[model samples]
Target: MGERRGRRGREGSAVGLEKYWASDPMDVLRVRQDFVLADVDTGSAPGFEGKKREAEKSLAVGAGILAGLQEQLFAGHQMGDDPRRILLVLQAMDTAGKGGIVKHVMSAVDPQGVQLATFKKPTEEELAHDFLWRIRKEVPEPGMIGVFDRSHYEDVLIGRVRELAPPEEIERRYDAINEFEAELAASGTTIIKVMLHISMDEQRSRLLKRLERRDKHWKFNPGDIDERMLAPKYREAYQVVFDRTTTPYAPWYVVPADHKWYARLAVQHLLIDALEGMKLDWPLADYDIEEQKARLATG
Candidate 1:
């Protein structure tokens, strides 16, 4: 049955999934309503048993597929079709490897087709508007992939942990986010929300390394230590996030990021899955191909 389906099935079909069951690691890492972050082993790669070298090779191949799919998406939009776009939202505790994901996984695709936005502390001007105002501006254009390093989720994560917003307001933001994401999904955006979960011990070691190296010092922030102290609060807040916002349209994937290589590979597969689901085809040529060929031959 698998072999027969392989010859006729789409990339994301059940048959395809069964064929690649051993390779695709996301099946174990995806966040469902009952997902408990504390129960997840941060040091282990759940479904992937491969080492660093194997993961690297897999990433190279996945990158090529991603690039081709992105091009098709772009071409479809250029042809004035209802092209779909991707929005990858990366949310993680400090040093859980968000930057690494962008550097290793995203670097494999066409930079021109990617719309990356790293949200920082809101400016006074931005503060005046809704929290999503800045986020709305950075959403991927038709046929593009948009990545948010830390997205509107910050309002809930940090706001809840730091008491930045009132308890009632923070509660309201969850419903607001669901509505916002539903709008994006309705408009043909495939939203992939990932939370890179790393161990507190792992984070401490990384921070220590950053402080020890002069070159890495710029990346270090004292505020990170402050945040680290509130790890429990942050975890609670994330649990709330997963409960409230992991909608059918935009589910969260809690990736075990202690192994950077595996995290990168898992993310690559997620992207491949999303693109394959798009089932994009090369745009048809508007001009007459035979006529163009004849004209060229005559010339």
Candidate 2:
């Protein structure tokens, strides 16, 4: 589906996102010293002033720009020499729409250029290694976009809330993660860490809907209710994560995710912004185009 976009997508920036966005998301959605998860209105769309209709329009426009930019990055990797890549780290509670972002926003680019990794329970082998051992193996190669469905932060989030590890060991992983990401950034990985923030009430509604529909029965997990019971602790764990891991090199953006459309659009803009910052150009042809054209004509 996305392959055709590479052939005719626009090269210019999609300005509607910039125009409708009230300010840089970093200034609004990024964690601040005074930021509190409880204070965030889950339904609110921070940094964007546009309504759903306008946002839908902006999303369509951005898709073209995103597709074209991805083409350039992929070209640099497969056909030319380029070292830059992107790692979009997504952390959220169940049903926060991580899969939706992957489907709706990332579908604009060719699948070959996108690498997706979902981190679930560690096998006995993975458990024997350090927490990041498996994660490091999934890092995207040059000129590709990498996504983490649920990432290393789960160690601190679920780990702390459930007391899976000793408190001291959990503490150590925080610094370990920071150093690991800094190293990746130095090696030319553009890291975008995002937390999809959803209200407990909204979560309840979604879960109820899943129960009502036969099709959604497969998605419902009774364990989710058990997890929901510990929402307060999870929120506190997330707060600690923000306090320690949010840094200049790999900052976190807590996207309000109650509205699935807004969350998708916001993440699309974030990806576009990260790619735009790269300032990459389409790789020039290695062969002489004129010579090839002349040879074809003579034949």
Candidate 3:
């Protein structure tokens, strides 16, 4: 069940979803295919409640394995002479469970080796600099895993959605992003961008449930309602962005997030697959074993 091999159980499990599972890849795909689709109220009863429990257990087990593999990367495993750097970026609409995904997916990684940056609205300082400045500060160092909870993509997603920048400016920024990502890839960073796709109904249900549960009420933001109102606009913006920006060097995975469990599993599997190919070997120094043994014998 180590992270490298944990995904074997669910490589195609999504393709085999049963009707009672409450969520299916095909259903989520349909929602995306028809962007004009209305957001229904799935909160009355979680469509996949029965199947959710089993999925959760599977995800927990998979996450445990992934953590261990991440440890191997930290331990200085190398594929040939090249050490690897992994930068994972998770993007999603409101309440698509970005935080939850980070918590569960990266739970096992060593804290020092993993840095998580969650980007919200730009600050005065961040805005003062180029869009990539704040992001540049968060890139993973060699032999580390960096997780950007939101990331530079916002300059494309939200900026375009709100018309914060002009058309020419937006076109220029996409080229900037492509170059930035290409540079990261060329420098040995494995850049994986994930876009978590959640249905409007699912989001609405989550928002309401957050309101009903006092303990979770803190997560309820009135602004989210406004964002929900802008859902179609955002989807249009995302579709355009996806088409222009999904690169071979840094591909985008549109994760079906209506089922949080499935979403988490898909990401974990993808990450594990990327890392397994790395085949890291522990880094060794020049010390001779015989000399070390002699020193030990002297002691």
Candidate 4:
């Protein structure tokens, strides 16, 4: 919006903005847990100085590039190469805009090239195996972008806060998660982990609005109030998660969620960044292009 700072790439693309931010939003919001939850500005949009309408316009352009890149990646997979895939792991508190992200940022891409997984309570069958058993089953196939609405981190986040598992087992999960993610990375998966940070007051306001409207009541979970009561504990759990699992293979970006537009824009930028880094190219045609053109003309 201001003086563009980055080298231009594809036409009408926001991927170049990665170079403009004084610090990339991904790095600015990364979680090393050097600071506590209170230290983050939930309403602040780092590395962006545009209005909602401008951000939305940029998002549309970015989405087009993302869709094109995704198609190339999918095409490569179809041509038999094990192309890298993106697994966007989204973790956040309730009403922190995860649905908005899936609906807005992700909707920019071809649906056939995307996989969405939402994790709820563990099923009785799911409980019998390792915590990651169900998660492993949903990892995106090559060339498709996978979105984990809430992920294995839940076993540590909610499991620790709610005391669903013993303290020692909870501690063990941190290392287990690190190892599991490393495996994913080694297997051609590029993980972009995000934790949407929203203030307590904002969450309270959103929850209240959900309760106030008859239509929105369907989205309300009474259990959310129980979790809200233990917000401080949950924050502490998240800190431990960042400290233990933010790795070079998979780092966590903490997006401020009080402004839904900023959150959506930031996530789209992150996805674009990941895809751009893949350096995908369209698959080569097995048949001669000139011959095929002549055949089509004759037909």
Candidate 5:
């Protein structure tokens, strides 16, 4: 994201939206082919100059815009068979704030039009089928925005990192993923895949805070420490995944997650941009307003 800020809607939101963003997050955060995972400054909010206070107010304004667009997406389905929808795939290591993104950002949209799925370790039933089988069942339907906390890419990431699958098998899954995503794009799902990149040191600090607070104890896991030992391996795996799966149909964006406010705001911009691209509008009333009013008066 060193010089990637697009800033398309910085002055104002999409035509009908009455909000504005300081800058475009996607242009700032979208991963390019030359991106190296190791070089990303997890602590830096690259291309963004806004401070926390400005970000908070901007986030609120963005939520209003998101609500309007999401409502139109719902209306599209309610009144017609509009197939447009959004699928936001989030991937990051533990304590990287995937839940925070959902809680703070997506909360702007109507629950009725949003779908949330968290993919943890596979269950017995999930293991019985292809990795995507369980995933396909959870995809957002018409006019819905679906969020995947951790997704099918786990098969390549942890699977490769832990040697859960043989190298050859792991290699095949990447191609399968690309095809699956292409199909989703063709079917009217706008895909936004993001990797919340946080520094190892930041993660350690957050983990310590969790351990210090009894109320946050449930969020911490000893297994996370085990994973930390394998940071080098995990990073290599992620870089490979970025290389293979990112396509025009399903691109990847990596967000710097050291600043919670910045991460949330960056994601807000990504979602807002995706929704804006669809040009959503309220479905027109099919019945005549005058006729309905006259009939109601006579009755």
Candidate 6:
């Protein structure tokens, strides 16, 4: 595909190629924009050891940014005038590091104000209601951050990919998702959706590592293999979702997950951009410290 603005056009370029070179590096590194840089083909690194090392380095940098953002958020809550809520909806196949991100990226944030919800297969009760009913209950309250480990997008992404629903049903969902997200945006919830993209080979290797290691055995689910087998179909489903749903109100970010650290960094920067854009003001208090000090002296 032809390149526009130094990055891949609409159709994403290879894994690491997009946005490698930018006039101002940060200009290419935007939170809500599409990228089209050359791919960095870091072929299998000597028995996967090199890949692990690279992944760790990227993850560390991302974690650092996350920690810094946590601090900023804490201070903002205490000393700043930001009242907008930030929500992160992480959607990916199993073993895509959703939990790891919660553990590492969010470890520093105050738990009292951060909510995380993990959605799995619908229960008999959940299926009984509209698809979004469960998700609606989990929306973050004011003065809090809500994290959806998996969210309403499943109605479209996984549902269509697995052929769990008919084509007409899938088509109907596109508008529903838009209106749902639009309502959230209109209501003041700043929604950020992240799709973690990992290569098929990387996923297989990660699954194998989980099976071979005793500590990781708990993550070994037979269903994971079945989902991995459907990557191509999932990719197609995502293409449709992305094309239909990437709107000004609620944009979707497709993050490269092979490098965990890089993903974290991108997410951190994106969060910062979103929060900073809010132009938050500190809440006003009735009493004035300077006036109170004067009154005390007079008394």
TM-score of each: 0.91, 0.91, 0.81, 0.90, 0.92, 0.75
Candidate 5 per-residue C-alpha lDDT over 1-299 given as tens digits, one digit per residue, 9 for 90 to 100: 10122233445543322223434677778888888888888887765666787778878877877787788888998887799899999999999999999999999888999899999999999998988999999999998999999999999999999998889999999999999999999999999999998998999999999999999999999999999889899999999999998898899999999999889988888887897788777787878999999999999
Model 3: per-residue Cα lDDT over 1-299, one tens digit each: 23344333333343222223444332342223324323433222233444567767656665666676687677663432445789988888989989887888787567877878899999999988889999999898777788999998899888988887787888888899999999999988888888787887889899999999989999999999998998888888777767777777887767767877767766766676677657665566557889999999989
Clashing pairs in 5: 4-27, 5-27
Ranking by TM-score: 5, 2, 1, 4, 3, 6
lDDT of each residue in 1-299, candidate 1, tens digit only: 22321332435333322332354555677888688888988887776656787777767766776777777778888885755899999999999999999999899788988999999999999999888898999989888999999999999999898888899999999999999999999999999999999999999999999999999999999999999999999999999999999998998998989899878888878987788778778788888999999999999
Q: Compared with the true structure, what per-residue lDDT tens digits does model 6 show for residues 257-285?
A: 67665555455546645655564443455
Assess each prediction's global lDDT (C-alpha) against the native: 0.85, 0.87, 0.73, 0.85, 0.86, 0.66
Predicted structure with the largest lDDT when compared to the true one? 2
Q: What is residue 121's positional error in candidate 1, in angstroms?
A: 0.8
Model 4 lDDT per residue over 130-245, tens place: 99999999999998899999999999999998899999999899999999999999999999999998998999999999999999999999999998899899889988888889
Q: Give RMSD to native, each candidate.
A: 3.6, 3.9, 5.4, 3.8, 4.6, 8.5
**Where does candidate 2 have its weakest 10-residue lDDT segment?**
1-10
The global Cα lDDT (0 to 1) of model 2 is 0.87
How many collisions between residues are there in candidate 4? 0
TM-score of 1: 0.91
Which should have the higher lDDT, number 1 or number 2? 2
lDDT of candidate 3 at residue 218, scale 0 to 100? 94
